[model samples]
Target: MAVTKPFDTILIANRGEIACRVIRSARALGFFTVTVYSEADAGAPHTLQADRAICIGPAEAKQSYLSIEAILNAARATGAQSRGLAVHPGYGFLSENEAFAQACADAGLVFIGPPASAIAAMGNKAAAKRRMIEAKVPCVPGYQGPSTDSGQSDAVLLHEAEKIGLPVMVKAAAGGGGRGMRLVRQHAELLPAIQSARSEAENAFGSPELILEKAVVDGRHVEIQVFADTHGNVIHLSERDCSVQRRHQKVIEEAPSPAVNADLRAKMGAAAVAAARAIGYVGAGTVEFLLDGNGHDFYFLEMNTRLQVEHPVTELITGLDLVALQIRVAAGDRLPLSQDDVQLSGHAIEVRLYAEAPHKGFLPQSGDLVLWRPPTGEGLRVDHGLHESGQVISPFYDPMIAKIIAHGATREEARRRLVVALERCVALGIETNRGFLVDLLRHDDFAAGRATTRFIPQHFETPAAPVADDTLLNIAALLWFERAAAACGHDPAASWSSTGRLGSPVLLQYGETKTKRLVAPSGGNRYRVQDQEIAILRRDGCRLRLQVDGQGRDIVFAFASDTLHLALGVRDFACRDITYQPPAEAEGAAERELRAPMNGKIVAVLAAEGERVSKGQRLVIMEAMKMQHEMVARVDAVVEKLPVKVGDQVATRQLLAALNPAAE
Candidate 1:
């Protein structure tokens, strides 16, 4: 039976892509949209998309998105409550906070998610596992005890680990998403692993509670999307395989896993439904499991009581808008489809576009995005919060900037189309994993549907960055020449025969390597650099059409100061013009400087002034992009200066410590 509309205004109590996603669905359903933002996101896409936007607090999440009081105040100040409002807590910040859900209920506002009781039942891994065991769900064998901060001694955890055997997973009981997780394979590593995981958990999730599970090696990460309503209707919308990962975070996801057959899907789907029902779950949630390689046995991992980052792939395959369904269910409407009514269509694949350098251990990067152009196609969808070029990708949020999804009649077609779409994507000024995603999709293992959770580690463990070849160097030189000519009040596309036969020497640097080349104009729109001849056929903003040594090529490029950021095919290059600059300084003392890898807050400082440290010893630990990074000593040296302390926010390349060589 249809009920009265519960709300007319929907307030998105989150930021970034997810906020934008909810706004689209809420507005489509004729609901007035309200969004909240931090000071950093004053001009963000989500804020701009909403009919009304409010600034909750500063950039820090605790003071903004995670603050229940601030969100409530914003809702009240905007008169959302007077008009009947529902708060849509987009995934991540405060999405699964039971207290926040109860607070909304106490304030006579509808929380567009599972009930507070359900969230509490499933939020803690230890409690959830105990409950699932009682509900007869197959779970990995291990220990579920009190947290370290809650009087659970280390001895008890160690004893449990020994009983469960080696190679166990230490996980945060209060959170998911791979944060506060560690895999311990050796006896000597268990203690450190537990400590590290506990610390990270306390910081990321506000809880130090932990659980142990038998490490399921070489298993496939599969999750089932389940939805329920107040009318006692629950259905699973197929399965998604998120096996390809790094640092325990999913990189690629696809719906209708290749490993699961009809029978297996039914069984897994039933188990997922059971898990949700056991917790009295409502709205959208995901039941994750680790599927064995044999494609038969599966074990429950955890249940995410919120929409997942990879929801688009399921939406594409099932032809459903999960966000819209979430809104409908929150408004006292029964589910539109039953279990038998749900149909999975064509295969769909999605990849996260992160502002990170894959070659450098997937280190998150932050800077002004000089250019942002997502590819458009029939079967492709790009969900992002970036609206225009020159937007700052701040360090206060996750590094994932967008998600690209593709749908096709078959898995191979979907894979192929995703690769092409990724290749066509243009994100410059900041480093990204676009090229890596392309290569991963084309890998023989991935193409054959044999990728397991160990896909990235087994292969591409030390993936190298693409090197700048001689041809690329020549192109950079020519582009630099054209820009220089234009800056001097001359048409770069015109002939440059007036410069004479010797040509001008250009010094270009790619990374730490520099090369000097002689470039001269041969004729109109033609130039000779070294032994290669190039002709510029066309120029459209950053796009260049040229014939290099009789081979026609098209390149996408951008200029930031003296640096030229260009994408030649799938490879990206950032070349700096060092022409007419003195470069005779040698790096001696600079090598002893220990600097922050990215913008983050220092969590630990292990070294002090006047202390001598060995090479490769970890000196500091900082939290950036919701992950911890260690700054290590480069050489055996005496600490000359220790400038930073715990809780200090640091910028990239800022010195954390300075050292001097030890006396021989």
Candidate 2:
């Protein structure tokens, strides 16, 4: 519906990135906007963006963003129009809460999305799957019927090792975004996983009920975006390839899967349409599916009954304002457009830039962001909630920093632009997944469109493997020394640059103690370090950039390691410190070696030297934060030794198992 005007005023009951986006859109539409925030978010972007901003409650989500009473009160206090909310629930808190939707209805206002019934229906995974089945939509095999967190009620779960066979996954009835789920491959591990999953489900969502579905081997996760209006009209916009993921969460998404032909797209699109019509669904929602690699069969996973994070790509393809469409539908306006009215034109891709590290084990990072520079220019759309000096990177909420999306005439162009866009995108003062995203886009399989949900952890390796290149550290050190020497007023051309001025002590800080190094510029764009001369290049900063021949040409830098990484571009390079710590030359003995998998702790050790173990048997349990993960043997072997134990600290490459196939 192309309206010549916007709504009078919009009440927003959400927080963070999506909320800020809604306010921007509403303002552009000539509407007044009211924003609500918690006490902790008094200075947040969304709060600052509103014509009228109100503080709802304290910092804790239960009393603040998630409190229905407080949100409604904020709405009433600031709103004077029809009392409707542009209501961008924004991915978390009250977005999917059905009771909140019903409350919005009882208070005489418009809910900008699906009805309360649809929210309640789609809220429950098992119920949603059953509804899809009734709607004639395809579904995954296994028991997804009326199952709750009854814990051990289904013979299908325990026998899952026998039924769908090994490596079956158990999911919560209300699980979304990867919580309340477990992967069990053995009988001994089933009950504990179920208990832990149930406990988490009950704690996080107040419902321990769960559903079980057969794990699709090498499943390519793809979802279709569909928009429906109150006029009983529905349309499928396009599809997003969300196969690059970790822990069941998507990191990268691309529109129009390279593997999906027009014929396959039609089948998936029809299924998505059937799903929306089944619930009499209205507004915009995404229907997720697990597509087989063979491009033959696909099944309905779940329908996200709200605007998705990756909606920008769909907008790029069809050139529709899904948010505006949602507002129009909520305002009692007819859809105006039918199924044929919607069209998919071009290719688009979205990357979720998070404040985490990829090579550092995708560890969640929290700190003040000294800098925030989003990539811009042609085909780039940035949706973010941070500023040059914002301070909301706490452990309280999701670590998503921004969403960078690019659109182009074709999928190849989109991918190419995506790579370049990330290179220019920058976020400092916190660990970020920018490097990981760049690595993924350049990965062999991803470039050729060989994607599945397992692509990330499978290809990148969790607890990132240590890199074999030592030249990067040497380069970084050289840059550090170069900057220090330059700042101390030393001619870089002199071999005795740091020998001290006229017999005084020359103190320079490297780590803690003041150290001096003999420095000399050897020829053009080159440096002589001790006995070796290395090539140095001019990076984007005042710091001396060095390129060593012994080291590889991969790690890129723009700033120093300090309170803030003052860089101008995205940290889009996979960096791993895989240096070999060999034994002393005289000892003639060595430790088997160890490496961390991701940034985590060693929770338990289940093996010892000469301990015979079968393939796929548990060898070690590494714990990160509050979750525990077990390391299993890839092949039948004897444990030659164990270097780690319970409560031991470890990084991704830390050794926990040593297999001797000959001993086995």
Candidate 3:
């Protein structure tokens, strides 16, 4: 067999799912892949899948995955003399870093992306907007120039926001991913948004520079997938509608947008191609646009200089492997297809499955994935980086666990298939947005293809905590009775004595209510759950089969660390096992302690010891999973003790600070 390209070995400078994704394509193309990981990810799934794995730095991204020097060194150390080497910056870390790209070229290695000059030209949001406007692409009317000086007053930004109108957007000039981006709906909110945006931008991209744009209200976020080669050939692979979003970040993405007709597609596609040509792009890139839902009007949002997270949807619709295209282009080969050769087939939709609690403001969750069983069937695809059961979802990176994609002959079919797929995708240990995704799919507006950037926030309401239904209570009682019997050194299967008497009673607590259930012997493998009779059909460890009122039901249930965990349908419920003695409460000031809600690094401390703070005042800022969360004061009190400092990594429920009553 002959090698088709120059590079026979590729180093993946990333971690998790994207790293494994790149490794799969690289290996299939006859390239031995090398993976770089942080110390914490030494035993991760991605590392084990690669031909060679290297440790770059510590757990923090700055010292590890994002370190240009560390990645380059690893690539050099893993290079084979007989084969050429290349580096693929999957998507997040250094994928868009121009310095890293240039360093690859300087070290005589092929960077599997666009030229450094192109990344430099488009990496900055402000500069990219200018280039797009110069290319005659319709752009949103706002400030695209320097909005602030380093560490200086943001008055200039506030003034520009006022000029752009009340509702303005502040975004990081250097990066994307919704970090350092905010939407201000009023004049009074402009300054706070700017300050917070600056802090986040600095932490994410190592720069505080920003750009402002008029927030597009009720706009459909449609993006065109464009590819260019060194031979001056550029073409668009059609579009994906990423309008269904929360926190200005896309949640669901699909190809062949319902609102994009042939004419509109042609127009948007042309603009995307032009944008790619303007930058002399040589690889896969995405040109994002904000389409006015009321009409055919569209404006250029920005261009992502690398392959997007939602590229799977585009691949399903077009029947193309985008990573393979990138590899070929990086090898100086011309694109295999021209504009006319490109075609769109069936509809495809992709939903990002994040390890976060939707009911808890979608805050990033970190814990072990006890049970991960993603759905699989016709036209159903799941791209994930998790290894197996007990794989921990860490706080050092993005919280997206997997991408669930479905393809069908029509948009409605794809939507329906995606809904069913989500229902069957059972992920148990930590919280996830699985049920919330199903809810969004079933919403009338989403089903009717009326979802926009504001759809989740405007149309969908955060579901309240669910109450345990009758079935759930019955299952809980059965498990509780079994646990009690085990504790008493009695055989759970033996429900009666030789004289044939009924079994003992069992007490269990569900939330705040404690109920006593009596299990009586009813022939073989049948027990009573309170007043209802449940026949045990089968039992497989935590998973069980029971006949309730003559109807059969299957469920997965477990008890871990004294917590009762159960998964029913698309929802997961965990209740504290209060069967033990109740613990004593903290006293005085300790009772008024503030604790970390999630595992994160402290980024800011807004309150000082001895400082009198009002209720609801911002007290601390923590960065977790690439987003900043503010912990505020719950009551008007004097800050008595501050335990943690900036840049300290704290675990979930770790005490952060304490407060005492303030003098009247």
How would you encode candidate 3's per-residue C-alpha lDDT over 1-664 as one tens digit per residue?
Answer: 1113377889999888888889888888888889988987879999999999999999998899989999888977885534789999989888988899999888878889888898998888888898889999999999876545632358777777878996889888877778899989977888989899989999877888888888888889999999988788999999999999887788999999989999999999999999988888889999999998674989998888888999999999999999988988888888999999988899999999998988777878875677787889989999998875767777898889999999999989999899989877778777888888888889999889888888888866575665677677667767776776788997776775557647556555544465555666565777766678888899887678888889897777766555567787787866543444443322232346787756778999988999998888888898877778888887889888898899898876678888876555
TM-score of each: 0.89, 0.76, 0.86
Best by lDDT: 1
Model 2, residue 130: displacement in angstroms?
1.7
Write the residue-wise lDDT of candidate 2 on 98-162 in tens digits: 89888877876567778889888888888898899989899987666444334346454565545
Candidate 3 displacement at residue 13 in angstroms: 0.9
Q: Stretches of candidate 1 above 4 Å error?
A: 1-5, 146-151, 493-495, 498-502, 583-664
Q: What are the lDDT scores of the predictions, listed in order?
A: 0.88, 0.71, 0.83
Best by TM-score: 1
For every candidate, C-alpha RMSD to the true structure in Å: 4.2, 9.8, 5.0
| Cα displacement (Å) at residue 130, model 1 | 1.0
Better of 2 and 3 by TM-score: 3
